[model samples]
Target: MDFFSRQESARRATARMLVYMVVTVLLLFAAVNLVLYGCLWLVGHHALSRSVWWWHQWTPQAILGTFLLVAGGSLLEWFRLRDGGRTVAEMMGAIPVDYATRDLAERQLLNITEEMAIASGLPVPSVHVMKQESGINAFVAGLIPEKTVLVVTRGALDHLNRDELQGVVAHEFSHILNGDTRLNMRLLAALSGILAIGQLGGFLMRSLTGGYDGRQTRNPVTIVWIFGLALWLVGWLGLLQGRLIKAAVSREREILADASGLQFTRNPEGLAGALWKIREQGSWLSGLHAEEISHLCFGESLNMQRWLATHPPIDERIEALYPGYLARMRQRQKNPRPAAPTAPTPPSWNPEGTLGFASTTGRFAAPDKPLFASPSPDEPIPFDGVFSSGGLVGRIGELRMEDLESATWLHRQLPVEVTRALQTGTGAKAVLYALIARFQPMEPARLRALLADRASFASWVEQVGGQMQSLDARFALPVVELCLPRLALSDAGEVTGLLAELNVLAMDNDHLSVFEFALLKRVEQHLRPKPPLMQRHALESRLQPVAVLLHSLLAFSSHDEAAIARHHHQLMSELCPSPPAIPDHGLPPLEALDKALHQLRSLNPDGKRRLLDLCARAVESDGILHIREYELLRVIAGLLDCPVPLLQGVIHE
Candidate 1:
């Protein structure tokens, strides 16, 4: 989906959740009111009275009190679950996850993650393993992108091997991508609120039964206390009802996650095999914390009443992914593929600027570069040309200007169908063409050149076409890196950063393999800028020593780590300081910065000052100033902000 559609879906989902909350709250409010009146009528022998005074004196206050109890309960549960999950991770200990320790199984997991993320255009999520649990399971947790976690069971990591694990993690990533994580978290919080009401009712009953202290009650008060006791009993019953509702919500989410995971990975057998192994192993060692997070896992983790199971049966899950999976399983007594290979180690990049530009001369280039020369100096770049030059344009407006005068109109006119097709296409070249076609009416000569150029577009077309026809059709995203040498060849930093962004985007929905990344460097050489020797040197010098230190602190440091780690983080922060991370609390500033970033990500350089003006907006998002969050935003701005000089260069031409 294009960015806006994803946002729209998220908004609609959130709105639905709010409606659910409103209806639930209103029902609870009415129910509490009934309980209050029923007690008053029963104890005082009062006739049914719906007097205004009765509401003012009792019902509203009781409803307000119940709301407080629910809110408090939710607060308690949120902290409890968050802390509990962390403790569980700690107890499991850190399973060694460096590049060196990964065997073929682990390597495959990482590569799949990279490929999906890049393909989907999102940040690469960090990977984690639950080293103890032998059951096949995985869960994603986190409220924000930076804090999100993907945890898999030991069985998933060790027992299933590479392909199966890829299927599992890919499934989890789908949940993260689909905005389900937020919904899942909200569901948990709301359930906590419901349970709190029951707890309050129980507490009142116990208090009445305990008998009031001599100093605390009069005869009349004692009589009222008797009514409280009856209400407490009803409250206890309500708790069970609340629990059932929570479980029902969780059960539906599991099935949805399963289907969505299949949609994302596009490999039914991979997920099916993982499920098969889970059933065969039959070692369901339920984690102590499973009850608290049962909703988040791949399978049923909670030992519910058989009727209250959160997940569909394992067989059902398998069949959904692979029709007649069991029948096929029976036929394949001999292993289908060679014994699963050992996980390969991730290669260490020489952090220095040594890596050469990959060439696209033969097998590696994408098939969709614009065939004709760039727009003539006197003419504006045509929208069609801009679309054809998908890899070239860094900003959205730069590609859209010829179509309309305003960005708003351009946003409205976006061709959703074309974008969708391009996004789902098998080859990057086809995707690139689709993206262009979506934005601008076709230009025959430009399309022809895009399809026919021997030295540039032709090779990419031939390779992508073949790949599309193959049994395992897949887009070669890294092939786009070949164009880096042609467009931003003179600036090594720009080329590296651009390639990294594309690489990250490719793996956004899947894992990016080191092989894919390496192969990209080779392709960029032949089809792009520089002599053969320069391309080779460019690839070799990529992992420079300085770059290694820069990335070491910049990319992975967590919020909690401090001292030297903190200093390195701070230094890295200073290196590219631009703006602060805005909390979700503020509005206008965030809205402006968001608009600016949208333009930048689209590759448009126009009106960048508008982005800088919104820096203050980001700083105030969370209501309170957090230095760390601010620093994070600053880091982002630094990376996306193009210097005035670069903009000036474009203008002068």
Candidate 2:
């Protein structure tokens, strides 16, 4: 499925999961109430004769109390987890991966992660490592797109080669792209209630029997024991259902992620290799919270009944990734003797900068030059082609091997100074300040005041600003993306300071330059908590914001005035058949445009897809793509929550 279909399916699955979760809770309520009714009948509060119904012993108040107890437990878990991926990772004792890390394995993880982020056309999410874990496992976590994070275990890095590790990272990113992180977090919250009930039972059984609390109960120990045993039994039943639900949901997603990994790395053997290692050494973790997080793992984290396993069998996964893979492995194992050599093994992925992908090369084992080209900012690009509008829209939310190469190529093109600057929080904000300063020439004093008042801070911004002197316009988005994780690490005061200064700078000019707009707007989207996810807003009622967005986007295009006007007319006609009267204010200010983008984000997925379709049509009218148009297109798409592929494949043939 494409991005749109996957998004819609995720929404449907979430809805169904909620229903199942609620039904499970209701069943728990019934079981507990029946237990109470039996206890009451034994005490002779009511007769079980035909004159009185058995449910009479289960009072309305008791039913409401049990229901409320289960609901409250679930709600508490949701509250604890509402903060997004960071909260989830912290729960599992994951340490964040710093870009400046000295360890080679850690650095490799960062590089591979950035490559995948570029492929998915999203910001590079925060990466975390479970250093103590020997399991070859990983998972993504987050409630929203901007808050998502990727995590991997130490064993994964140690055991897997570049190809196998890259394949593992690709699988986790597929979770991020497929909206599985959000769904997985929600499932975790839902099951917390069942776990809580079981714990409550354990507590009662211990407390009443002088286990932990060490209290001697002299009155009615027999009744108390019966009640405690009943709660314990019912809680165990609830846990059974919870695990069954988690297993059913997690199994299918694991297979889907493996398939996506194959698409992304274009090396089935890489993922198959990872699975084979898991088969040998196992993927189970010894972390304190491993059981709680098992369903979200890349490999099955727990040994359980086959019917209740969270992931498919390792051999099954290997076979799925490469048909007859297990049998071939057994055949090789049986033949211990040296066999006659036939064909040399192909090299693992090499991120060497190569133009005209696919036709020019097949084997990437050994490249003559450095793995990638380190082009000077002034160096000419070998290709500058148009977006394949008629066909490429489907590339959104999809990552491929070429996309990974493009990501690596883009990473290498950056000057070392800029890459280093992006590693820190303040330096990242300073880099943005530098990019914004480049938008409109400002006097030295004015820029100093707008960027920072403190000499230490202002000097840093100016230093990074110097690095921007040789920067190309095409690199603007990348700089912003690299800044995301760092910016996320910055204090709220720093983020707010950056935003305040940006608005002051933007307002002084009274115009939104294409580069500045994309730069600042993306930063704001990440720092500011997005409005709650809601899809109830109708497209018909949002025509005006749609118009404002279209106008602001076209104004940045490299097309001639006549062509721009013609494309606008065609788009507006298709977008609004009846044509609601909109203001004729040629182009909106930066603030208005920003507002329009946010408003359009709530459009139903299909509505947003059509808007992109019309937007692509407008670009097609120009018959070519320019850096400004490309950035504007991405900015618009990001605001709509629809990510496009990075500037690599589309920028070439």
| Candidate with the greatest lDDT versus the true structure | 2
Off by over 4 Å in 2: 48-54, 210-218, 335-392, 439-452, 505-510, 558-562, 586-589, 649-653
User: Model 1 over residues 1-653: C-alpha lDDT tens digits?
Assistant: 42223334555665765665666666666666767776666555444454432363477677787778777877876665453233334433425233223244454454455444433333334456667777777777655333355666666766665456656766776666556566666666666676566556556556654345668754565554555664565455454554455555555556656775665555687688778887776435466556556666776665567565656688888988899998878676555755434322222222331111111111112224311123344543222321122212232111121111121121222232212222221233343332222223333354445445344543443333333332110122222321221232134564464346444433443443233322333333322322111111221222222223222223222333344344443433432443122223233332333333323432222222223222322222222323222233333333332211011011101
Candidate lDDT scores, in order, read 0.44, 0.73
Candidate 2 residue pairs that clash: none
Candidate 1 TM-score over all chains jointly = 0.47
Which of the numbered candidates is closest to the native, going by highest TM-score?
A: 2
List model 2 lDDT by residue over 367-450, tens digit each: 355333445545434323333443446767887676677666666666555666776787787777777776565555778776
Q: Which stretches of candidate 1 lie over 4 Å from their true place?
A: 1-7, 34-57, 75-119, 201-256, 279-289, 305-313, 330-595, 598-653
TM-score of each: 0.47, 0.88
